[model samples]
Target: MSKGLKTLLAGAALLLVWGALAAYTAQMSLPSLGGGIAYDPLFVPQLLIGAGIVLAIILMVQGIRPLLAGIRIADEEPQKTGRILFVIVAVGLYFAAMPVLGFPLSSAVFLLVFAFALGYRKPVGLVATAILGPLVIWYVFTAGLEAPLPAWPSF
Candidate 1:
């Protein structure tokens, strides 16, 4: 099968899955106290799923032209699957360590290791990013959004 045909089929499948999930989310019960309010627990999920379904449909429509013309899209260079797997494992470990080490510490450590693994060799840059990035993110989530984040370890 042509690449366009494959793309169209994949997009259609994704659209179907997203639509079903969105429908299911829409059926979930809202909080009783918030009956007259605009807020609903499933609102965000439904919105995101709706967006995904729209995007997938667009992709499928775009693919149809090339598919009908019997044109095959050129494949891109293969990715480094091993590096991808390593990053996934590293992220998993970071999340696993978060409860014990706390978000700031674990995130900093993860950033340092991840940067090094991705070929960033500058110690100053690595150290700065490791320290500042998590702090900024924590501040934004906690202060700006009024969301609570895991605190630093007391010890």
Candidate 2:
């Protein structure tokens, strides 16, 4: 009906479709061995992913806010478009560098680029933030969750 509601409903439909696919994949997959432990897709991570998709679909259907609101229009749409393009390029470069330089290095470069673009004067501070943010995320994901990242050469 309303714009926001319509958007949310569309998102919900997508989520449901994704979840159904996940469920089907999990059900059809055979157990795979990982680190001497066999992983069955019907449980754990795949199930969790499916649950998340279901939740998203439910939220979209519910439409938490009443009105369907469109994206806020920029006073000058060209500037907004430029910014979006820049962000896509920055993120693309970061991912491209990930396999070669690894996550830490690529993330650092991204942060630095973002800082400079946003008018940060101190190169030192930008470097620090870039380095530290990725390191922290790496620590949390790897150490905390015990999920190792994608390595360059299958180490």
Candidate 3:
């Protein structure tokens, strides 16, 4: 199959899934208190899903040209599947360790491991990024947003 056809099919499938979820979300009942509407939890999700569906349709329309022309899309370095899998595993580990190590520490560790896994070789830059990135995020969430994250393990 042409790359465009594959792209179009994938977009269609994604659109279908998005539509289904949006429909389900729309069916959820809004909260009420003393006959007054109180909350609608699914509102944001429905809006985001609607936006995704629109983008998927756009992608499908763009793919039609190459699909009709039967031109295959050129593969750009298709041998990186192992690296992709490694990144996925690293993310999983990061999440699993978050509760124990706390967000700032676990995220820093994950950043370092991810950078190295992706073939980054600058030790100073890697160290700076790994340390500073998580600290910045932690400060934004905790101080700026007033959202507290898990604390480091106390022993």
Write model 3 residue lDDT over 90-144, tens digit each, in one string. Answer: 8888888998889878888888988897889999999999999989988999999
Q: What is the lDDT, from 0 to 100, of the residue 3 in candidate 2?
A: 51
Error (Å) of candidate 1 at residue 121 is 1.1
TM-score top scorer = 3
Location of the lowest summed lDDT over 10 successive residues in candidate 3: 32-41
| lDDT ranking, high to low | 1, 3, 2
RMSD of 2: 9.8
What lDDT is reached at residue 127 by model 2? 76
Clashing pairs in 3: none
Top-scoring candidate (lDDT): 1
Global lDDT of model 2 = 0.71
lDDT of each: 0.85, 0.71, 0.82
Instruction: Give me the overall lDDT of model 3.
Output: 0.82
Which 10-residue span in candidate 2 carries the lowest summed lDDT? 69-78
Clashes of 3: 0
TM-score versus the correct structure, for each prediction = 0.49, 0.44, 0.51
State the lDDT of candidate 2 residue by residue for 19-138, as single tens digits.
777767756856566554346445566667767787886778556454434343233323567878888888888777777777776777778887799689797888779988889988
What's the distance in Å from true for residue 101, model 2? Answer: 2.7
Provide the clashing-pair count of each candidate structure. Answer: 0, 2, 0
